[model samples]
Each structure stands twice: as structure tokens, then as C-alpha cells.
Target: MAETSPIAIICGGGPFPFSVADAALRTGRKVHLMPIEGWADRDRVAAYPHDWVPVGQYGRMVRVARNAGARDIVFIGTLVRPSLKDIRLDWKTIKILPRIYRAFRGGDDHLLRNIGKIFEDDGFRMLGAHEVAPEILAPAGDAGRVRPSAQDIVDAKLGLAVLDAMGPFDVGQAVVVTDNVVLAVEAAEGTDRMLQRIAALRRDGRIKVSAGRGVLVKAAKPTQDRRFDLPSIGPTTIANVKEAGLAGIAVRAGEVIVAEFTAVTEAADTANLFVTGLAPSSPP
Candidate 1:
């Protein structure tokens, strides 16, 4: 029984990881949550029923899971890019590092895939965030009250197309688009900063791009793995959207995570920004 199998949670930072732990507990599963040393939100994780461990203790995680008779593990929460200087690489990670580097350099997906391989090779299964926290996964159609207008629809298509091209490259998760013109592509600066940059560009009158009075589409890369670092939007996102003078927000249907759905919608309504999820089949 999957439900009875001890579940190991590799937790990083943020509230979402705790939410997932709650979901697992609700399913009557025994959870062992390993919190990353520096990045893991300890206070939040401590509130949940779990056993915490330092980050990069791959061997310990493996051993803990094995001891608990765990066959399934889920990685949740936000992972920051840590320097090599900060890592506490266990024997397992040390042995796998070179192979992980060869896969696609030192990115989240690269490391995760390699780690997943480790589990699979050991006859354990790696589960995605959606499996444990189905409630946060993006739903069909729009999420908030404001649906995409005609122009918003067009912008969504352009954003998705660009995302399709860039996702495999793994530069970032979000892009800011208006009227089918790419305003800004999210890089190391992050989504909220990227939106701020777009707003600055408009304020300076540097670009004459017209995406209408307010409309921006944020979508996840198609190649993105849901196990770690899924594109998430929350109250801060809605606040930033409002600050950016964006009319509507669009994310790929069943792709992005609405971390704070109720608050996001409430903020969107208050800001008069349309918030909707777009199906890949929807017209531009």
C-alpha cells in the first residue's frame, strides 16, 4: 500500500513544503521530512509532524528512507542556488556529482534527475509535488474573476510559445509579455523583479509596446519537472502584478502552482487585474 509506505519528504524553504506535509499526513501516511540546512524554513517545518535533517545529507536521507521502509519520496519547497562552498555533500552526492554535472550542468533539474535515478536504481519511487499537494496544482481555465480578454489571450499564446523555446534551456520560469511582445524574460532576477523591470520600462517610455492598459501572462516552462521548484504564484505575485500595471495574469493550465489561491484572487479582484489559467489548446 502506497499510503502505508513511509514517505520521505526532502524539504527546502517556504510554506508550501509544510502544506504538502499536511496533505501527506491527511492521507494517513507516515512522513519523514528532511529539511535543507540553510534554506529550509525550520519554524514552518517544525510545526508539521516530521524528522528534520540538514541539507545535502544524501546518504542520511537514503538511509532514513531505507530504515523506514520507504519506497516513495517527495521533494517540496523552494531551493536556493547554493554555492559549492556551502554544500555538505555526503558520499552518495559526491559519487554522483560528476554524472549530475554531465547531464545538464549544475541546475535543479539536473541534480533532481540524478537523485531520482538514485532512488529508482535502489527500487524506490520519486513522486512529484502534485501527487501529494493536488490542491495547489493549477486547475482548468481561469483561476480568478478576471478572464483573459482578446488581447490577453494573444499575449498568453506568445508567452507560452516563448516559454516552450526557453524552458528546456532552464534559464527561468516566467516571462512578461504584452500584446504578443516579450517585455522581459525572467532570469536570475526572478519573477517579481522581472515584473518590476517591465513596469520601469513603461514608466521610462523606453518601449512603445502596447499590451493594452494592463495584461501580463506568466506561464511555466513545458519541460519543467514538478518535483522541485515548480513555478509558484501567491499574494506577492498578485501584488507585483498590480504594481506592474498588468491587467490580467495567465499561466499554463495545470502547470503553475497557485500557492495562495484565495488571497491571489482576492488581490487580483481588488487590483482589477484579470487572473486566469490558459489551456495549451486555447486560441491566441
Candidate 2:
């Protein structure tokens, strides 16, 4: 008898999904990917030497994983608004109708927990995105070419405090701050949109101006389930910060993922934006 290949399901939503697939391959684990609609890069995903599935075909998604012999399934990526209005939901998805409906009324954490439960019940154990590609999980302190300023430290502490309050509920992952004041907290609008909000607030003087000392603190909610949506940063993050005139970024170590570190770090260096990874003040 031959030994079976270790397999893991990759539910990809963004660039990190592809990066996770790359890491899984290097580990000799066959990756089964289910790419999310409107957000994933299908071409890149297909090139990665992994099995691929559609965005919302939940039933087929399970079948593919099982066929690929995956016993340890891991999810990574962002889920966009469920296309409830035009969804061709599969039986697997339909089975979770009640929870799905509730999620529409509920906020981010509510939906993620419910989805996590559904996967758990279906015999697929989900792990955080960090588990597969831990290298991208930025370490504490500086990464390259820049260090956090005094105001960046102040904003990070303030942002972490705010997230600590909301972590238990998993409502948000990133906060935009200037000086010691929070300009915006991420909601359904996401990081880029949230930064846009911060930009608006700065324009109107709702918070301190963002010429300097403005940083984005990205975090995982206290109750953050590892499988579905872990906090992430990448080249896009740097681009957004540059556009918003933010000075730096801070995220919790081991709780966040970066898509392509070289490109992201290079962009950050170009913008002179410091990127630091932090740990919870105390264990959750």
C-alpha cells in the first residue's frame, strides 16, 4: 500500500491565498483551492499547481477536497458580500440557510463564526492562514528601512486598545489613526475604504491631520477564528497608505498574513512607511 499525500484545502480570497498555496506546495501538501469571486486572481491560482474550484459552489467545494484526499483543510482569503440576490447556492450552503440569513443582519464576527461552525460540522477542520505561511507573519519591531515613530507607537497602542474592546466580538481588524486619535475603525467597508474614511475625517479635521504620525493598525479580533478571515497586509496595503498619506502600519505578530513580502516591503520602503508586527499586550 502507498502512503497518501497530505492535503489541505485552500479557500482563497486574495493574494494571500495564492501565497498560502505556494507554501503548501513547498511542504509537499497538495492544495485544493476554492477561489472567491470578484476578489481572487484565477490565473495566478491556476498556475500554482493546485486543484481549483469556483467561488460559491459550496457542495462541489467539499467534494473536491475529499477527492483530493484532503484531511486537514485550511481557509485563507476575504469573502465579499454573499451574492444573496443572485446566488446559486449549493445544498451545503443551503443547509446553513438559517445562519446565513442571520449573518446578513449580524456583523463580521457573527458571519465568520457561523461559517466556521458549518465547516467544522462538515468534518473539515479549519486552521488560520498563519499556520500554512507563518513566515509572512511579521515579527515584532521593524522590518526594513524604517522604524515606527513616537506617534506611530502611540497610535498603535491606541488602536490595539480599541481592537481589544472589539476583539471578543470580531467586529474589526484595522484602525486608522493619527497622533493618538483614531480616525477610523474598519467595518464591512474594509481597509482601503476605511482609510478613505480616515482621509475624509482628516480633511474635515475630525482627527489629527495625516501629514505625519498617521499609521494603520491592523489586527485580528480577540475572538478571531483562524480559518476564515485573518488580518492581512500586502502591496495593496502599502498603496493605500501612500494614497492616504499615512506614515506607517502595525499588526499583531502571528495573527496577520502578508501576501508578497518583497513587493510589499519594497513599496513600504519607497513610501518611507514603517511596518511593525506586535503581540497582544497579554495573551488572549
Candidate 3:
């Protein structure tokens, strides 16, 4: 696609959708923001050329994007898996009910790929957020003043191994490890909630490890479709890690999206937490 062509962003909750929109705009592309009704922030969406879309209005989504002269579409931000009843299906979605049912029979990755295929069949190209905004990807080495301790590195590697082992099962993209002990794995609740679980455990004394002793590791699943659902972190992640009593956060370099890089780094520095991007070879 030409750099000057208009791009469509199907936004979810959080700041990532705006971040990607900004990046695309910087590259001289016109952007049409389609914010998901319940998930996306209204004030932010109002700043762009946008239409509010509900979860199951696939037909309207396509029509709106086409009207806006957008051929490339990117999906970003946080959206919990909605049940069928939660979807307000229009005729287009109702016609594809069987496909949607089949898609939901598998894991998140499966559902996303099937959804993307539906769009692709409609002649719209699905793109990853990182593709439109390469600058949002995490880089190798530390992102803040702090660096991981030697033991922290070991824990991070173990966390990555755990994720890799769970990848084929489409389990989750993040884990917490302290002193080689697995504290938690991200599941339907997501990364933030998983970290919250760790924080609760520490508070209840179930996790005896000292503060600043563990690592929070996030990465893409081994067979993940990178076109959507890549792991992402931001300043909020730093806050969560600090609350979870972790030594640092480690994510796959160039694979995980770093939202609000400057704010994230500043948060990490202020909290005295390390945020490092691990190279592919760093994991076992």
C-alpha cells in the first residue's frame, strides 16, 4: 500500500490505538479511527476522523472503512473476549454466525486469525500495530536507568521458557517468576490482572520472595499471528510491576509493543524498576 493512502484503525481500549494513529499520521497517511463502542475512550477517538463501532457490526465496519478510502486496517489496544450474547449482531455477522462460533471454539489466537481472515476475504489488508508504528516496538537492552541483576536474568529466561512451552496451547503471553518459581501465568484475566494476582499473593504472604526479586516476562506466542494481538506494555505496566514487587519487566525485543515509550521509561526509572527488551537468543 502507498504510504499516502488512508489507513483504518479498529481501536479497542487504552492508549495504543491513538499511538498507532499518531505514528501513521507522522508517516503522511490519513487515518480513520473506528473505535469499539464499549472499549475505546470517547475523548481520544473524538480527536480523529472517527466512527464509533460496536463489537459485532462487521458489515458497518467494512462499509465505513471503505467509505473512508482505507484499504489497510490495524487493530490495537485491550479488548476482553466477548460472549456471543454480548455481540449485537447485524445481518453481516448473523450470516457468518457459524464461522464465528467455530472461531470461538478455539483460543484467542485462533479467534483473531479467523476474524482477520473474514476481513481479508472482504479485500481489506490486516496489519499489525507494530507494522504501522515501528517506533513503538521495544528495543534491546534496558529502557531505563536500572538494569536487571544476574539472578533477574535467570528468572526472566525461565519465564520465557514457560511462555514458549505454553505457546502451542495458546495459553497466554506473560508469566511471573521469582527465584525460579513460577508465580503466575496470564490467562483470560490478562497481564495486568495477572500482576495484580501476584501483588495480592505478596500481600497475603503466599509469595515469600522479597520485593524487587522477581521478573515479569511478556512475549508473543510461538505460533502467534503477528498481524494482531502482539503483546504490549506501557507506563501502566511499570506501575503494575512495581506493585507486584518485581525486580523488572522483560519482553521480546522488536516483538512486543512499547506504548508511550518515554512515559514508560520515566515510570520505570522513578519506580527503580528495570524494563529490558530481551533478544531472541536470551531465552532458552
**Best candidate according to TM-score:** 3
Query: For residues 17-118, could you state the per-residue lDDT of candidate 2 as single tens digits?
Result: 777777777876667666655666777766754555555566776787787777667777766766576666788778877777776676666776776677
lDDT of 2 at 247: 87
Kindly report which residue pairs in candidate 3 clash with one another: none
* TM-score of candidate 1 against the unseen true structure: 0.87
Model 3 C-alpha lDDT versus the unseen true structure = 0.93
Model 3 TM-score on a 0 to 1 scale: 0.98
Question: In terms of lDDT, which candidate is stronger, 1 or 3?
Answer: 3
lDDT of 3 at 172: 91
Whole-model Cα lDDT per candidate? 0.74, 0.74, 0.93
User: Candidate 2's error at 101, in angstroms?
Assistant: 3.2
RMSD of each: 2.6, 3.0, 1.0
lDDT of 1 by residue, 171-265 (tens): 67777777666878888787888888877887888766653354556666666666667787888888887777777778877777777678788
For each candidate, what TM-score against the reference?
0.87, 0.88, 0.98
| Model 2 poorest 10 in a row by lDDT | 1-10
Q: For candidate 3, which ten residues in a row score worst on lDDT?
A: 275-284
